[model samples]
Target: MMYPPIHLPIVKVTVLEDRALVERHAEVVLSPGAQLVRVEGLSPLAVDRSLQAQLTGGSVAQARLHRAWKQKPREGSPEGKTEPRRRVDTLEAEWKRAQVDVQRLQSRVEVVNAAREDVLRAIAEFAGAGEARPESWHEQLEAVRASTTAAEEALRQARQHAERTRQRLVEAQAALAQGEQPEPLLVTTAELQVEHPTGGSVSLRLTYLVPCAVWRPAYRATLASTGGGESVTLECEAVVWQRTEEEWKDVELLLSTARPTLGAAPPRLVEDWLRLRDKSEQEKHTVDVAVREEVIQKTGEGGAHQTEELPGLDDGGEALTLTARHRVTLPSNGAPHRVPLFAFTAPAVSEFVGHPEHSPLVHRVARFDNRGPAVLLAGPVELVRASGYVGRAQLKFTGVGERLALGFGSEDTLRIVRQADVKYDTQRLTGRRTRTHLVKLFLSHTGERPVRVAIEERMPVSEVEAVEVKLLEEQTRPPPTKVSEEGILRFELAAPPRSQQELTLAYAVASSAKVSGL
Candidate 1:
């Protein structure tokens, strides 16, 4: 075990898988009503471990948020590229580190709460876990009370550390949201302009923004002022938002009139603000805003007209319409007026695949090779067979990555389906041999309501490759209140009868990668 299991009077938690035991105990045992913040070291690990796994799946995964300690743009290191790092990888590592902190703080919280519970049980005259007289219970409670103080102090310090890290993360996030400069989210094709204050509205081309408000880019302002009549410097951190998804993805935004403070180290005119932080923005004037990144994205439900099981075929086809809305607050009007931008269509997945030469997000070489084994497919069931070599078989992959290659599709779907790709790391690169029992399923749907091809892992049998697959769960229609993803097709009505969705299941495993017999 990498860490110890946590125990508390209020919460006794045992670690499950990669989850932190203390946080689990708090949720299941202590039952704290207060909502735990999801920041690093705050939220429980169990919430999104699957998604976190995919973000950090690669062997070379790691996120590097530039620190002040890193020197100024030496020679080749422009805007901190001084070293460029993989983002999704870093986010995954950050999430893992955050989970560890969460476990630590939660451990302290659980211990303290358990001690508090002891005091209550003592005062309320309730029985302790083990038999104890009222006087004995009181003494036990005193002992617990003494320990609680130290636990409280420990929790406070841990929280302080987490908060400082959070501040840095926030600043980084904020800067990324700006979507400015070399860290380009989209390939810039045209020039644009932004209306500014003092200088009034000047020329700055619209480098990026969509017809669909999945990402509405707006010019931001950062003001710095001193009490005395000191020169008030100006800075702006761009903000990009998705109106439909109600999300703010991290995109680099341009920084104008930004400079480091006199006493600050590593002075650079511009820096990447991937997260938000408390910066010098006391006295600043309102500047004009530019919005873009909306596109019409229409999705088609049901499946292909055919029912033949095809390898790697997606039945939930979609259409995307790109459009943008502009809400401008001029010097004259207190209320900002809104206007609609033009509309365009994004490429469908099939189209993107068909036209690999044009599609921006997908790599041609990224293909699924079913060389391992086959998955079982019976009726509506799909599952991978059990393997003795590695204990369990699972896989995780991404149809796309974080940046906006943006021909079409919702980032939400990517977060949901492509985000959580979990496959067992059973196959060691060394000479050791292992078996992976995976199933391959081919599906085609031609129904009003898109169907879910439910899949489960089959347990191993004592003899040969024999295994039985189980029907775990199916998602025909997502919850009405669910956060709808653009990549997934939604069915407003119930699943119709007699509609067929063809499916073929294939399973595979890693028998041996080396030639030991030779």
Candidate 2:
């Protein structure tokens, strides 16, 4: 026999990068025999194969999902209206009442205008006939003027009221139009056949996966200056977007970085073969080469595995799950809602960083370590200072105990000037080409306090034996503090109040005659 449909309310939701897993729970009394139970009011986007049900004090023999149509009550029907429908009806009625008020006030204004015109006509006729004394005529004219002025004042007030009512009516009509959208009629339902020898109250939990739900990582970094030093509060949040046609009210939320749709099976492999051939007569005579910039694709920290599709924010070589600190209520409006996951505060070191080759302005930078339990995903972070929101910057994937730096904004009190000079010469006997570059940077501080600045510069790196690159240490006055193998020069400087500092860098590039492009 078929039993009555049960009411299962959503209790928990686990949101992933592309979908969500919803769980519902309910308890009902059942008879001590086999019966069919149905649970309705599920989102139509629920996956059929992902439906699972568990029961206590009983066992489920079979469970299947099917689409069911739920017809809504028509306008003015006996059944009650839904919340949105009721709101639309209320606004519509208010709009009609407002329209009536405007019409009545407009009629009052018209009547006042017509009466004033009639009184003026009567006064004109009486003056033309000359049937009264001058004083009497004057008194009648004065009375007519007084009454006409009163009528005009009343008309002006009535017109103002009408205009206000008209505006309110327009607003009400707009609200009604916005709330009149039709809701979906189709819904997914689960039907389960159960068996119980002796049943009283059976608790059931239903879980299913639904699409149209996605989440991404977001952060907010607030830098505060204290007596001890500067500290940064990094707040991690998840921005969720869903249109599952079901409201998750006060449900436990769990955000995951797993992509179940991609599957776990490895990709198919294909054989790769390499072959070599002898050079032609034209290539053997001279070596042909060209120089071009190479583009590098960043796969994240530790070089995460590459996928066919673009990587997500949490594509940092591992998967992680984070639970919300508090229960969340998210509506299915297809808009983004932020849920706070966790936050941590750490001591930050503030410094000014400059790359004169790119920009003349120096940026205020903050360095801090991630002391949180989980890895911080790469995403856009909103930077806040003591004054207010400074700017926005991107935070790379950072693991526990790893340090990261963010730039708040450009420092206006500090200025940088950069100049470069280049010279090319050819050796008389060797025919070797040499290019020399002399670079200078001037930093000026206008503030009352001393500040430390870090400068970065890049030098060309050669990968071929025919090309040589060297840094002229003797020629460069006050040389760089450190130089990386990849040809990056770093300089640290201290600028006192109202003082100036200068730095110079000299480099040379020598290419052999066989190197066609230098």
Best by lDDT: 2
lDDT of 2 by residue, 324-416 (tens): 999999999999999999999999998899999989999988888888878888788999988899899877777788787888889889999
Worst 10 residues of 2 by lDDT: 295-304
Error of 2 at 217 (Å): 1.0
Model 2 TM-score on a 0 to 1 scale: 0.77
TM value for model 1: 0.17
Off by over 4 Å in 2: 74-184, 264-273, 280-308
Evaluated with TM-score, which candidate comes out highest?
2
Cα error, residue 327 of model 2, in Å, equals 1.0
> What value does the lDDT take at residue 506 in candidate 1?
25
Per-model TM values vs. the true structure: 0.17, 0.77
lDDT of 1 at 109: 71
Total backbone collisions for each predicted model: 90, 0
